[model samples]
Target: MASNRPAPESPYTTAVFSEDGAERSVGEWNPTAETVRPVRGRHRHRVMKQRGGFARSSTVLGVGVIAAVGAGGIATAQNKPAIAISLPDVDSLPGVGAFMSEDAADGAEADRERTAEYETMGLAAQEAQPTAAEALRSRILEQAEDQQAGAAEAARAAAERDAAEKAAAAAEKAEKEAEAKAEAEREAERKAKEKAKAEAKERAEQKAKEKAAAEAEAKRAAQLAGSYALPTSSYTITATYGQSGSMWSSGQHTGLDFAAPAGTPVKAVGGGTVKSAGWSGSYGYRIVLQLSDGTEVSYAHLSSMTVGAGQQVSTGETIGRVGSTGNSSGDHLHLEVMTPGGSAMDPMAWLRSKNLNP
Candidate 1:
């Protein structure tokens, strides 16, 4: 049975435990109090040394526990205080006494309460802050997104630049092709014009040659006309050579006669020198011309003689005027041809040989 009486105050009180684990205090005689002197020497020194060692060890253990909590090594229990650890009673050992009292128990309880509150606050702070792994992952994701956006922009710009370059090249090619086509067209036109000019020149040269040939032919014909001419113009043959007629001095007509009006001009039959020009017995006026071939041509019936003896005359030159001056009944010209020996021949035949029509 335990007594309920209050224990007496004693500085040397020691703690003892019963079989039931109940605590009790035992009192002892205090000789130091009876002596009435201050405590000194080794006894005080031993007690103070023991107290300092205990305080230092306890402070180190507390700091270690706080550091563990801050480093996230311990899970703080929020709903309870820490379990109290009681020191062993050492009253039976020499120079040792009760290590814990009622006051010490109270202080231990307060310390436990404070430790619980601190743990609770530390856990709350841990919950409020982000973890290291979570922060690192967020930073990595943000950087990756930024890099991806930058790469996409660079690719878009490259594509646009390539497209623009290709478009410019295509336009340049088209321009070159157009210029080449225009040049070819101009060349073809130039060739066509050159061909046309050549053809026109050829045609003009051909026409000039034709005109020159025609003029040359006309000039030759005029030269031929200058070399020959008709003996007389507008005359009619009245009597032929060797014709039977009664108005002849001979038995037959032996000369040609041209009937014309009076005063008709008579031209030289060919180029010659005049041999005679005078009036005769039965002829009113007469003229004779000797040719270069020694042939004599006589005009027996003429009204007047314009040429004198030994005068030079050309073919178709006026040598006498026509009239019936010899033994003729009307105005007519009797033309006779004679050899160099003075033999009579047909004058019409002689005129035909000279390329002339009588």
Candidate 2:
């Protein structure tokens, strides 16, 4: 009868091998077929023909045990992992598919863990993006403000320089103008001083000329007294020419008088040609003399004569004698000086005219 459920695993049909032992079969079977021998340090697979219960059972058990061991090893390795591992060369083994599968599973687990870590890092980076953007914007704004401040400072400095230059220019111009004004004032003062000095000199010279002319006119208008010589022996005047007298030709004495006894030589007062040297009627033995400037002198009552009419005579030369000649007067000589215009003046006063005051 055919069973409905699968057949139970048979121990006699299962394969069995050893790590360091000889190859052996666990169960008995027909020895009529050829058996393939495993190499040294190797394992073999078994094929199922009619009943596959042994093969299936062994495969299941191998997978379950490997899974459990790998899980336990991963848990233990989290704290203390193996330092060195000696894995069997799977390429040398004929039936190592199960071991290869186990290694692939470990690789898959590591890849899953790495992917989870990267995902966590990405989430953290995404959360910090706004702060980084704000920092960059702040840096840009600060740089812009700094540039604006620098430009403002430069502008202010330029304006200050221009103002300073303008002030300096004004100061220079004012200084020049002040100097020019000072120079002009000095020139004006110098010219004014020169003009004042010139005017003073001119006034001084004009005053000197006027004073000299006035003094000359004063000398010209002065009165004169008659000139005479000492022409007698012990003869002295009893009265002057202007004295009031009893022997009068006028109310005053008309002529000078010399009271002498006899003849005395009379001299000419100035050099001239004699106009007359002879006697006259009232003036006895008188001589009339004319000078170079047309003035005449009279000698009255002469004792003798040494010069003739028209005879040239020198000054201080004797011309006649002094005696009582005319009008019963004593011996005398009358000397006179006259202007060309017939004006007579007193000889005594005229002799004092030249500041000699003789």
Candidate 3:
């Protein structure tokens, strides 16, 4: 195509648009057809490798889009909004773009196509690594779940075992307590039995002692019966011992009197030796008999004495004759039993001890 611009001038100038949206000339020069051409894929262009002095360069910029009007120029002033501009593509430069032949352009386009394919392959490799990481994380989560389940089961088993051991210990303690209680009861029963047996034996021994004492008393009574006898028969008792009356000298009678005829025979009461046959002051005629057991019987108011002094006489032998003698109110035998110490006894109680009821 032929150029519309006329010619070049000495001082170079360019055209620009103003703030009022008008076009005007700022400088004058025509870039001939050799120096300019249509833009070829301007946004996608890259810088080529340097050859000779002709180096072509391109760059990507993140700026606002330049909107255009009728003329293709940019302009701005201070404090004014910036206007748009459009660039004209050139085919040749004095030292650049001249070495870029059609063959080299084709080769550059092939290299760009191969580089895009290689970037796509690298993207696939990066995506595969994250997928494997996610799978490994899943495997770790599954193992953690299994371990938790196992731990829960083990804890439950241990709890059951501990409870069982505690139950067994409690049972053993209870068993021992029961046995101890039973043993204590048995011991109490044994002591009670022993105490009862001892009490029974004591009662038996007491009864035996009582029986022996009774038997000994009976034997003594039998011996007294065999050894002693009553003095006289066919006589009336008068003037008993401890009788009070002024019959003669002593106010109280000291002997038992057997009333009989004046010549009645007085017999010896028991086996005895004659202690005396004499005439006493109050008794008149008297005889004192001494028994083998040291007891003395005196017969007073005897009319006559048949057994002399120191005569050994048997039971019922004639010892004297009854008579009304000195201090006697009548013919009666006055008999007295005396202890060896000369203390007078109740002759009635004394005869009973000898098994003589009278």
Residue 53 deviation, candidate 2, in Å? 38
lDDT of 2 at 95: 37
Candidate whose lDDT is highest: 1
Root-mean-square deviation (CA) per prediction: 17.8, 21.3, 20.8
How do these models rank on lDDT, best leading?
Answer: 1, 3, 2
Answer with 1 or 2, whichever has the higher TM-score.
1
TM-score of each model, in listed order: 0.37, 0.33, 0.36
Model 1's lDDT to the true fold?
Answer: 0.69
Q: How far is 299's C-alpha from truth in model 2 (Å)?
A: 33
Q: Tens digits of per-residue lDDT for model 2 on 195-293?
A: 999988888888888888888754432211223333344666554546686666666754445555565667776566788877687656767667666
In the range 1-358, model 3's lDDT, one tens digit per residue, is 5554444344756664454547765766444334333223321132223321122222111011221211122122222343433333333433334435564456445544544454445445434545655676688888998898899889889999999999999999999999999999999999999999998889888888888888886565444423666666667888788999978457888888888878888887777689999999889899998887888988998898888898887766788788989888898888888998889987776777876765
Model 2 regions lying over 4 Å from their true place: 1-120, 222-358
Backbone clash pairs in model 2 (N, Cα, C under 3 Å; residues 3+ apart or in different chains), count? 11
lDDT (CA) per prediction: 0.69, 0.57, 0.67
